[model samples]
Target: MRLSIIRDAFDLVTKTQNLSSSKTDEVIDQIGLEIEIALGKMHNTEPGVDCKDVLNELMRNLLRIAPLSQMEGIQNELNVPLCEYKKILEKYFNPDISKAYRNFDIDTHTLNQIISKHFYREGLFDVGDHFVSVLGEPESAAIMKSPFLEMYQMLEAMKDRNLEPALNWAATNSDKLAQSKSDIVLKLHSMQFLKILQNGSIVETIDYGRTYLSPFTSTHKDHIQMLMACLMWIGKLDQSPYKALLLPSNWERLAEELKRQFCNLLGESYNSPLSVTLAAGVQVLPTILKFTNILVKKRQSMNHLPVPIDLGCEFQFHPIFVCPVSKYPATEDNPPMFAACGDVFCKQSILMMTRNGTRVFQCPYCPLDIDAAECRQLHF
Candidate 1:
């Protein structure tokens, strides 16, 4: 809406300029013609043609049509649209984000360290170093250097279509990978086999598959079979049934998987904290701004917002349990309890239902009867 108003103002100014220029030209032409006619009349009569009266008449006509007063009027007309545009901007433009900042009270030093560490984790070594130097904490930069550096080096190798570094890293952390039940190693080997099939000889491809893929056959039998079938279409693999193996998306997926495994080994999250926070903010900022506007209009204090803001399931990182019996959210103090009959309720609610001089409480969801003492706390 603001843009539309500004565009209209611009168009009006342009039209006003064109109209003023044309009117000024017309006034000048009329004055010139009057002078020419007056001179012609006096040209054959006298030596000194005193055309003062004619000149005064022309000046009066020019002033009446396109004077300095009219220029001021035109400027006033342009100012109306411009003022309207400014008013619209002031109405909708919210530059105050202090409401959002009011909730956070992080330590300055901690915030700086976190930012510097984030820079290092993102492979901005020089930026991290400069930040550390500015903060007079060179040791922070030194402490954070090695781990992310190795991770990025492995990623760089993968980008270059060289998987040796990643493969070696995976082999070195095989035990931890197995404990996590991650299939990254097998997926990496599969990508390696596909690379060989795309560029190397059939003999070399078969050799590579046998050496790398055989270990994963027990868990990924069908995938291995499909990969081996690609060998039949050696040179014409694009038309083969297993052609999806050659897709660039496969490499991208492998890269993501490798990064996930790498972060898991380092006891870090798969996604950067800053990225997750920004994404969550993008999801919730609209609702927050709307609420803020409402509070402002109502002339109410916004210090406490009791209303819930739903940001959808995507932003819900952890499980949330609501008790069906109590119709309330389950918290640590009153957790969800699972009964022997497969029905769940808040602990306090279940205890209340069974405390009427009876040991057994009929399950609300099922026909089975169960004792409240038999209930167990359920964890998400």
Candidate 2:
């Protein structure tokens, strides 16, 4: 429920933003076109189309469109949704984020490196360079600059709807990408194929496909088939069932995929490590804030959370098998064992109860009894 409210508020703000931009651009374009036509007539080299008459007509059309009023109306259209969105935000998550803050041992050098590196990761080379020059080390920036620069260049070209740079980069790294089990190269070509086909150039699309896409046929036959299916809908592809291929997000997903694979090739993470840390911290802040007082008191004694922190599967790096019976995490010496009723407990806990397989033991959480031999050591 909390997430839904936030999502709806966010969507309202975005919707208003898109509408505002569209309406403003549309009004400006219409006004500009009117001025261009009026100017051409006012400087009438053609016969007797009165300059005064053209000026009057222009004024009438301008008045009809009412650019200023149109803009004011668009602003009014935005006010309610935006005001509601702001209210929703303040109502839901008004936490003092400072409450979750904790001091770290990071010194000047490491902090500079992180700040400078984050700038470069976002493609702000000049800012990053300046930042490093002041109090940071420029060498740290240089280490990642080359690779990230190329990635930023591809991203820029992608923004302009030019895929050649990204396609070329993907082609060059085809071997590495394939070795890493990345299908990004195929994806790049697929987008390019649709782009060419959408422009009503069948010969080029087929030629490009035959040259660049045929190789992926054996491994990605289904995807290739889906692309080929679009040939029948060519120029009218947007009206076809496969129209989703043309969404703006496809390019975004491709760009992110390219970034991920590029970083994978360079043995780096796609997200800046600092960004990852901050994101994790944000997700955990609420839980920590709830137990702030207790945590502060036992800070030295506690090695883990007072209660389990379910960070979901994405943040979980490894399998955790803490035995419920013993209330301790599993280890090599005391591995988790599954009994007949599918209940798991530490090996030592079972041993103490069954006396090293001399007798049957009942499952801790269920009524089922089992011999020690029936229990199997659980692997992560």
Candidate 3:
């Protein structure tokens, strides 16, 4: 309903503006025609043209039309809908987001770094530089900006179907990627091979695939076969069974994967850490405000949320382990531990069962006896 009101308001404004513009144009055309007729009559005179008569007639024509009043009326018409639109917007949106804010524990330097790095990550190099310069710590932020700058450059190159930069970066870090079980290098080579196949001879395509795409055959045999099968279709690969692989979406996915791998190589996450935090915070801020307004009105600190807030899966980095026995989430100080009997319990919970590691006890889920010393720490 609010958006419908806004649309209606803007529609009225546009209609009024068009009408006013048409009216003004018609009036101006009339005035111009009258002045031209007057000038023509004055110019065709047998004797000296009466300049005073022409000036008087032009003045009279302009006054009779009252162009200024008509313009003022048009201006008023435009302003009417504009004023109402502003009021409607202010009424419906209630955009005072400051109402949701609370002071949280973060130092000035940390905040500056986050803001500066976000600007750089977004490819706003000038903004980031100006910000860091004002902060008088430009040298500190220089190191963090270069990696993201290169990643964006590669992304831009890929936009133009140029893959050399990305391919070189992938080859340089192939060892790390292989250790992580990534086949993006092979995928890049396959894309390059496909490009060759699209415009070159079948023999040239085969030769390129042999030189570049052959190395991934051991691990990516099906993928390699798919590339080789394109040889049969050659210029008409769009009709082949592998046509789905020829989509622009394939390039988009490859670009995203390249960015992820690029960040990994830099020992950073695919998403900016500051972006993730703010995104998660945006989700939880409303609940925080609700509590602040009603339940926790006099709270001194917002270091920890007064209640649990479930954010979207994008914010979840790993599975949350809750101690089954205590029915509480396991924290780093009380991390979950795996028992030998294939059961898991929090370290504190396991300590309680084993009497602080002084005695052997039966597992809660199974009948097997277990000792706390035998329980291994679970990384997750």
Residue-level lDDT of model 1, residues 102-126, one tens digit each, is: 4657799887877887887788988
Which runs of model 2 end up more than 4 angstroms from their true locations?
1-115, 229-236, 239-242, 295-303, 321-379
**After superposition, which runs of candidate 1 have C-alpha atoms over 4 Å from their true positions?**
1-93, 296-299, 320-380
Model 1 lDDT vs. the true structure? Answer: 0.79
Per-model TM against the reference:
0.62, 0.59, 0.62
- Residues 256-301 of candidate 3 have per-residue lDDT tens digits of 9998887787777888788898888776765666555554467554
Error of model 2, residue 7, in angstroms: 11
Better of 2 and 3 by TM-score: 3
Clashing pairs in 1: none
Worst 10 residues of 3 by lDDT: 299-308
Candidate 2 lDDT, tens digit per residue, 1-380?
Answer: 77898898889888998989998888788889999999987776477666888889988998888657777889998888889888887765556767556676768777767777788888899988888778646666678577789999999999998999998898898889878999998888899899999999999999999998899899899999999999999889999999999999999999899888988998877788778778888787767765664666767433445566677776765798877776678899999988878788899999888975476987767788888888899888
In candidate 3, which residue pairs clash?
Answer: none
Candidate 1, residue 240: CA error in Å? 2.5
- What are the Cα lDDT values of the candidates? 0.79, 0.83, 0.83
Root-mean-square deviation of candidate 1: 9.1
* Model 2: lDDT to the true structure: 0.83
